[model samples]
Target: MIVLALCLVDEARCWAAGESVRSVVDENALEGTPAALWDVDGAGDPTIQGFATDISINRGETVRFKVTTDASAFRVEIYRVGYYRGAGARKVADIGEAETFAVRQPECLKQAETGLVDCGNWQVSASWDVPARSRSGVYVARIIRSDTSGASHIMFVVRDDDGGSGILLQTSDTTWQAYNDYGGNSLYEGEPAGRAYKVSYNRPLIVRGSEYRRTSFWANEYPMIRWLEANGYDVSYLSGVDTARRGHLIRRHKLFVSSGHDEYWSGDQRDNVEAARDAGVNLAFFSGNSVFWKTRWEPSIDASGREYRTLVCYKETHAGEKIDPSPLATGTWRDPRFSPPNDSARPENALKGTIYVANCCRFDAVTVSADQAKARFWRNTGLDTLSRSQSVLVGLRTVGFEWDSDLDNGSRPAGLVRLSSTRLDVEAALRDFGSNYGSDTVTHNVTLFRHKSGSLVFAAGTTLWGWALDATHDDPDKQSAPTDLRLQQATVNLLADMSLFPASPNGALVVTQAPPDTVPPVASIRSPRTLEDHMFHLPVSVSGSATDQGGVPAGIEVSVDGGANWHPANGVSDWSYTFTPDRRSFVSILARAVDDSGNLQPVPTSVTIKVSGFARLIYAGLVGLVLGCGALLLAFVARRRRLLAKRRMMGL
Candidate 1:
C-alpha cells in the first residue's frame, strides 16, 4: 500500500503537516471534464481505478482528496501535464488503506487558487489567496505521487492578484545567444550583446525566443540596482511584463532602470519608456547596449495548458518564417510599433557632461595635485586614445560626459579643474604601482574636457565612478595615487552643482555671462539713406553681410529716410540679407544678429541707395540704347587692349 502525508507553510515560512484527506472542488472544473485513470496493481494489469472527476471550488479555498483503491496491495498515483518546460508539477495527495488509501493536501497549495481537478485515484484543487506583497503573474503548483516503484507528476496554475507589475527585459533578436554567456563574444556574463553598428548602418541584432518572453538574464550583478537601493530607492525585480501595461507601471516609479546589458526592445516598450521620460520619470541606462532592436510577441499555449509566449524579430531562422522587411526596419509591426524611417537621431547630449565613449579606451583617474594648478590650460596628448581612431570619438573625451566644445570651452573661471597632458613619469608611476595595461610608450594624448553641468551628470559617467573609488582613500599619497583625481574631482564638482538645481524648491533659472570676446559690438547706418520701405517680390534680389562676434544676423531693416523709421528685410542667410531696394525713395539697409540667448546685437552700418529724379531719367534712358552701345564698345576696346598688351608683354 502507498501512504502519503502533506505539509503546509505560511507566507512567513511557518510550517504545518496534515494526516487526513478532504475533497475540495474547483468551480472552473465542472462535470464532463476529461479525467485520467491510474492502475494500482503491480501485476502489470491496467485497472480503471475510479476517482472523483470535475470538482468546483471558489477562490481562496483549498480542496483535498482521499483515494481508496479496491486492490489490497496495489499502489496508485496521479500525474498532470506541464504548461511549459522547467515548470514543475504539484502532488495533491497520496493514499494507503485496506483495499483503499487516503492522501492529504500540502500547505504550500493553500494560499493561492490553482485550477487542478481530481481524477478519483488522486485529488486536485486550487489555492486562491495569494499574499498582498507578491508580484503579479501566473503561479504554478506541482503535485507528485512517489514511491519505491516510480513517480507521477501533475501540474496546475494560479493567477496572481496584481498581474502586471514587473518590468519586461528584452534583448536584440539578431544578437547571438553565444554572447549571452559572460566571457562569450567579449561580453561579460549577464550583459546582453547589442548590435555592433547604428540602426542607420543596417546591422540590427535579431531576436530569438518567445515574443512574450521579453526579458533575458544576462549579467547577474546589476550595479545600478545596488546604487539605487543604497540611495533609498524602491525597485521591483520582475521578468516579462505585459506590453499594454508598461505605461502604467512606469508611472508608479520615479526612475526606470535598464540594468545589465539591455540591448533590445519592442516598439511599444521603447515608446512607453520614452513617454515616461517625457513625463518626468527619470531613466538610468545602467546597461551598455539599450533599445537597439525591435521585436514582436505572439501568444500560444504550452503543453501544460498555460499561456506560451514567443517573440519574433528579423533574422534568418530555420524553424520560423523571417519577418520580411522587418517591422523594425519597415515600421509596420503592431503593438510596440515604432514609426518607420526609424529615427536614427540620437538622444540630445543636452544633459551636460554625459557622453558615450567608444570601446577599449583606457581611462585613468589622475588627481590635480597642488603643483599642477599653475597651468592656464591642459590637454591630454596621450594617456587615453580612442580605439577606432575615428574623428567622432573626439567628442567622447571629457572629464564627464557633459562637456560641450562650443559652450564649455573657456566658460569656467580659472582654478576650475582643467585637463593637461605631459610626457612625464605619470605612466611610470602607475606602472610602479602595478598597473600594466597603460605605460610610458602610450603615444597619443588623452583629450579631457571639464564637465559644465556640475557633477550630477558627471557621476553618471562610468569612468568617474571608478575614480570615486580612489577619492575615498584617507592617505594623501594614496588619495592622489590614481593621478586622475583632479579630472575626477572636476567631474564631481559639476555633478554637485547640478544637484543643487534639482533639489532646490524654487525653480530658479541659472545663467552665466558670455565671454568678453563673444559679446557683439553695436553699429548703425553710416551711408546711403534712412530706415524704411525696401519691399520686393518673391524673386527679388539684394546683397549684404552682417557682422557679429557671437550672434547670427537674423534679419535686416531698411529705411528710406535716415533714422526716422525702419522695415525688416525679406530673406536672411548666415550674416547676409538680400532684397530689392525701395523704388520710391533713397533706401538705407541695417542688419543685426539674434543670439541664442535672445539678445540682439547692434545693427551693422547701413548701405544707402541714393535715388534722384534726373538720375532716374538718365538710368531709364541708358537701360537699352546707351547701355548696349556702351557694353559693345567697351568689349571691342577691351579685346583690342588685351591683344596689344599680350603682344607687348609676350613679344608675340
Candidate 2:
C-alpha cells in the first residue's frame, strides 16, 4: 500500500513538472523499489520465521517444522485449534527455546508457465511427529522472538479422521494462495490485476492483505472455528483441496462447512459435494458463491523439490478458445462465455440450490420472513425473541460485497424452505456488463432444503455471515458492525440443532427421519381435467396430500396423453394447476405425488372431463365413442389370442 501511495505521488509530481515519465521510465524504477516488496510478513526484521514439514499429516505420521531466526533467540510454541471451550487455541506443545537459523528469501520473479512468485526453499531446524492424541485442525507454530515486540506464526493441518458427527471446517486455502502477494506476484497483483493464472503454496501469504492479516484463516476461518469450539461443538478442520482429493471423505461426517471467501473449486470437488449430499451428508455453505468454478489439479515439484504444492485454474479470459481439450475446462461452471464449447455445464445451483447472481451491492439489512418465524427451522430459538426482535437480524451492513440465492433454474431441489432475504439495489456498473448478471434488483435468500437422503442443507446466502460470528477477533477492519445477539443466537441455535444427529458408537452417521415424508404421497385430480359449459367452473387442478404417516408432499406433476409428457404442479399446500378448456370435448390427465424422500406415489390418479361446447365437441365426442367401443371389443378378442396380442401390445 505504501508503495502504491508513493508511486501515485511520483506520477503527480512528474505530471506537474511536465515530464512524461511513463514513456521513458527506465529500469531504475525496478532497482529503486524497496525491499519490503519481497518481505513475506511486513515486520522489518521478521520477528520469528518457520514452515511446516508437510501440508497434511495422518494421525500417526511424523509432523515436522523448520524454524529459524537470523539473530534473536525465539520461543517456539505449538497450539491446536479445536473445541477447547472455544478459547480459540489450546496450547499443546512448548518446544522451549529454539536455536536460530537463516531462511534465504528468494527474489520475487513471475514464473513463465504459472504466474506465482515462488519463495522459500530453506532447511529445517525442528521436527515433531504428530502425536496420536492430536485432534484434527490447523496447528499453528507460534514463534515469539524474545527480543521483539510481537510474534509471527506459520501453520499446517493434522487430518486424523472423518470427524463423524463433528463439523468439517473447510479452509479456503486455495483462495488464500490466489491472494498471497508474497514476493510481489500474487494473482491479485500485476498489470490489469489477476494476471496470474496460478499460485504456489511454496510462498508465504501477504500480511494484512486479507482480513485479520492472516490470509483466509485468521480473520475468516479461525473466528468461526473458535466460536463453534468455544460453544463446545466438535469441529474438525481440512482444506477444500482435501475434499477434492478424497471425494467420499465426508460420508461419515454429519455436516460439512465452508469458511468465508471459498470461491475457487475443482470439478472433482463439486462432484464430491453433490454425491455426499445425495448420500445424506448435511452441508452448510456458511459463505457465498460456492462451487462456481470447474478446475483440475496436476502434480508438480516446486523448486524446493517438494511434491504436491501448487493451485492451477485456467479460469475466465485466461482460458482462451484454443486451449487443449480436458474434461476439466478450468473455467466458470455456468457462464457460457467462459465454459468450453461442447462441455456439459454444471451450475452451482444444482448443489447449493443457489449461485452468485449479482455483486457490488452494499450491505443491506437481513430481514426474516413470517414464513421463517413459523417454520421448523426456528427450533430451539425462542419464538418470543425471534418475533419481537423487529424481524431484522442486522442492519444494512449485514449483507454485502457479494450475495447468492436460489436462481430460477429448472433444478432447484424439492422441499426447500425460505427463512429470510435481503433486497439489494445493484451497482450500475455490473448491470452495464450486459450478461445474465447485473440485475437491477437482486434478492439474496437464506434458505434450508431437506435432501431426499433425510439431511438438510442450509445456506446463509451472504459473504458477510462469518463477520457477524467473529467477535473475538476484534481486528477493527474485520469487526462486524452494530453487532447484536440475534445474529449470534441464530447461529448458536443452528449449531445446536445440527448437533442432534450425533455419530453412533461405531462411527456411523445418524440419519434423521423425514417427518413430512414418512408416508407415501397420494395424487388426485381435485377438479375435472376437462370443463363443461354448464359446469359450476372450468376447474383444472391437480391436488394431492402425503400419505397417512407424512405431512404435505414436496412435489406433484400432471401428465397428459397417458404419461407421454409431464409438467410440475406447484401449489401452496397441495399441487394445483388451472387450465381453461380450449373447447375440446374430452381430455385425459394423470396426477402423481412426490414426497420429500422422492418417493413417487403409486396408482397415479386419472380423470377425463367432457366439456359441453357443441358442434366440434359433438363431432369429437362421436369419434371418441366409436373408437372406445371398437377398442373394447378388440381388447377382448386379443385377450383370447394372448401370444399374438401380447407381441402387438409390446410394439413388437
Candidate 3:
C-alpha cells in the first residue's frame, strides 16, 4: 500500500506562514448582506436584470453595467463572494439611489434574423472604478430596483493579473451564457433553426426566473468558492474569457482548477490550460462536461462592435441540419468532421482524462472498491476500513447532472487511475449533443493521472462533486443532498498533496512523503499460455494481468510481431489484444507494462505458439481432392473395361 504519513513540521510551518491572498482578504471583518435580503427570488420579478460590459477587469479598471428595467432607478451592490465568516459574500461597494450612479436605461435591440438580443445599445446605468488594492475574486452586482420591487444579479471577476496564487479557479461563465435564454435566445435554444448559433454576452444571463441560479454562479461554482475559502486555500478566481485572452496569468499559478459546468471552451483556452499542465502546474477538474464544445469569440453585433463579447458555437451536431458556415467550424471539440479548413479534433478526454457521457442529471453515488480506497488520496477517509464482502464505499449525490466517462481513445493520458466507478442507465435521458454516442449505459469515473512532467491531473468526473462538500449551494433541481465528510476529507488530501496546505482547522490529515518509484511493474500473459491454448484457430487472442506495487499501472502494450511493434491495449490491470496470423507459421505474442511513475517493465512476458491449423487444413483439402479425382478416374476406367469385355464376348 502507498504510505501516508505525517508531514514534516518544518515544511508545514514554512507554508503555515505563507497564508494565501484569499485568506488575508477574508480576514477583513466586513459586513455582508443576508441571502434573504440580497437574493431576488423572494423580492420580485427579473425586470431589474443586467450584465457587465466585460466578464473580468483588472484592478483600477472600470466595469460598466447596462440595465433595462421598469424601475426609474436601480442600485448596483458589488459583493465579493468568499467565506467571510460564513456569510458567503461580503459587500465590497454599493452604488445607487443617486441620479449620477443609477439611471433609466434604453431598450435593448434584438436581431430578427439570428434572434440575438443585443443590449449593447443600452446606456451604461452604473460603473464601478475598482480599487487598485482590491482582491481578485468573483463579484456579483446585485441590481435592486429603487422601489425594492425587484432585483437581479450581474456577475464579473476582479483580476489580480500579477499576483501568483497557489490555485486559480476558472468560473464557467461561458456555460452560464450558453444556457441563458434571457432575451429569447441562448446557444441551446431560440431561433428558426431551433437554437441560436451565435450567443451575445451583452444581455442579462438567465434572468427569467429561479433557474438563473441553477446554471449561473450558485449551481456548481459557489460551493467551491465557499469550501476553498473556508479551508483557506490560496485560491484566485478568473472567468473563461480571461483564460482565453490573458492566459499567461495561468502559467504563474502552481495549480489551475476548472470548476462547475464548464462545457464551452475556446481553442485558446484549451491550449493555455494544457500548456500550464505540461509546465508542471497541477490540474484539478472539479467539473464535468468540460471542454465538450468548441466555440470562438466574436465582436458584438451592435454599433460599438466590441470584440470578444459574443460566443459563437454552431452546435452543428445537435442541429444536424447545417454545418457552421465559418472556416472555423463550431461543434464538439472531439469531432474532426468539421467542414474542412478548420476542425477541433481534440477530445476532452485527453486533457481531463475523461469525457462527458451522460445526458441527464441523476444523483448517483460515487462508489469506490476496497482496493481503490487504499490509494493515498483516500487515506483516513474511513473507506480503507471496508471489509472484503462490503467491497464498495459510496458517496451519495456526488455524481450528478451530466457526468463524464473514461474513453479508451488513443488520446488518453498514460497512468490514468480510476478512483470511483458509478454506472448509470441513460436510455430515457439520452439526447444527442453533437457526439452520436448512443448507449443505454455510461459509467461515470473519477480519475487521476500523473503527467510525464510529474504534474498530477485529477478529474471528479461528475458536476456535483462540490455538492458533497457544501450543502448550502443552490441546486437547479432543488434536491437536498447532505454533506459527505469522506468526500470533504478526500478533497483535503488531494489539495494537501498538491502542496497547498489547509490554513483552516481540518481534522487529522496525512500527507504522503515524496519518494522515487524505482520498482517496475510485473506483467503476465493470462491467456494463450501454452501451445495447447493456441491450437484452436488461425486468428488468436491474447490477454494479460499487470501488478504495480509502487503505484498503479499506467498502461499495457502488446506486441504480436515478435516484439517488433507494440500497441496499447484497452485496459491496464486486465488487458486484451487480438490479431490474425498472416502466415501459417509460428507466431509470438509479448506483453509489457509501465507504471504511473514512469517505471517500465524490465522484462516482457511472451508466449510463442505454432499456428499450423491453416496449413494443415489446406493440405488435408488438397489430399481429399486428389483422392476423389483418382476414384472418379477408376470408376470411368472400370465402366469402359466392362463395355469392352461385353463387346468382345458378343463377337462384334
RMSD of each: 20.5, 18.0, 8.3
Best by TM-score: 3
- Summarize candidate 3's per-residue lDDT along 510-603 as a digit string, tens digits: 4344345668788889888666434335567788888988666656777778766666675667778887776666677888887645456757
Per-residue lDDT for 516 in model 1? 24
lDDT of 1: 0.28
Query: If both were scored by TM-score, which would come out higher, candidate 2 or candidate 3?
Result: 3
User: What residue pairs clash in candidate 3, if any at all?
Assistant: 415-554
Off by over 4 Å in 3: 1-32, 42-44, 99-104, 207-213, 339-344, 387-390, 428-439, 508-520, 526-545, 552-652
Q: Which regions of candidate 1 deviate over 4 angstroms?
A: 1-130, 134-221, 237-245, 300-308, 315-326, 330-652
Question: Which of the two candidates, 1 or 3, achieves a greater lDDT against the reference?
Answer: 3
Off by over 4 Å in 2: 1-50, 66-73, 82-86, 96-100, 108-110, 162-165, 191-194, 210-215, 303-307, 317-327, 336-343, 380-397, 428-439, 468-470, 474-479, 482-652
- Each candidate: what lDDT? 0.28, 0.57, 0.75
Per-residue lDDT of model 2, residues 14-72, tens digit only: 33454322210120121222212211243223535555645667655766665556534
In angstroms, give how far residue 646 of model 3 lies from its true place: 42
Assess the local accuracy of residue 1 in candidate 1 as a C-alpha lDDT between 0 and 100.
Answer: 8
Give residue 290's error in model 3 in angstroms: 1.0
Model 1 Cα shift for residue 502 (angstroms): 16
Superposition TM-score, candidate 1 onto the true structure:
0.32
Q: Ten-residue segment with the worst summed lDDT in candidate 3?
A: 1-10
